[model samples]
Target: MISFHFEPSSLSSTEKRDRLLKLSVVSSPILGAYFFSTGDLSSPFACPLREFTGIPCPGCGLTRSLMAIAQGHLSQSLSYHILGVFLFLFLVLALLYFSAELITGHPLKISLSGPLQRHKRLLFPLLGLFLLSYHLARLALLWQSDQLLPAILNSPLGQYF
Candidate 1:
């Protein structure tokens, strides 16, 4: 089974520092989103998949969702992305856990990966199917609103379609 046990005395100084560094790298974006205002932000680029095919990828609107979350607008965030709240909570929890470990000089000892390995076969396909269906539903809504054709036509690669 894979599990984390915190024990300050279980890790060397180098191990603690290395773990903290990795956690810091992963948590940087969460900090940025919390401190920055989305109103002041503008995108210089579009999603490559969307720019080319005019269909949003699975992660589309995630930035906006994070921004909304940062602004304390949970409903707005949900409107931007259905999965945003879960992602936000996961990041915040991970950041807090790692920060606590760093401050207390504790390291998580993750032992054996059998449990996760056993679940992957069932988990991956379910996740993929959910995403595919969600994307199809989004496309149907856009089509119903008469926005689908325009989106395709305005895309850089749409002329070939």
Candidate 2:
């Protein structure tokens, strides 16, 4: 059986951030699949960062993109977020991996983390730069279209202010 445990004091800031990032990326595809299977186009979860900061998080458009992909609208998905198709493909691979594990009675030890850990010094910075650039571009587009203020005002937490 699975168990829940917490030890906030044991984790460093970097560890906490890494855990949060992993949770977001890993959970998105699974949750998207669940919503798709259930015919729920709307996600119940909102990005806490976006809600509070009135800014789109790196993963902001993911759910809508996933929804569009589920409906076989590739162009619509790309418009929402360029990474959605990649995430969807990752989800498919994960499902296959899980199924293979079940059939073979042996969990595949696919160590994606090994390479990540090895090159993390270089990889992490590049990833951060890319995310930052993409976020800035997204913000610029919103600003150009005169949607920035509206986005801020319409944000869940912003609505109260």
lDDT of all predictions, in order shown?
0.76, 0.70
Per-residue lDDT of 1-161 in model 1, one digit per residue for the tens? 66677775755788778768878876866676666645743332368898898878887777677777888889988887777787888788777777767777766565657777667678869878987887888788889999988888988878886
lDDT of 2: 0.70
Off by over 4 Å in 2: 1-44, 109-121, 153-161
Q: What TM-score does structure 2 among the candidates reach?
A: 0.61
Question: What TM-scores do the predictions have?
Answer: 0.76, 0.61
What is the TM-score (0 to 1) of candidate 1?
A: 0.76
- Note the residue pairs that clash in candidate 2: none
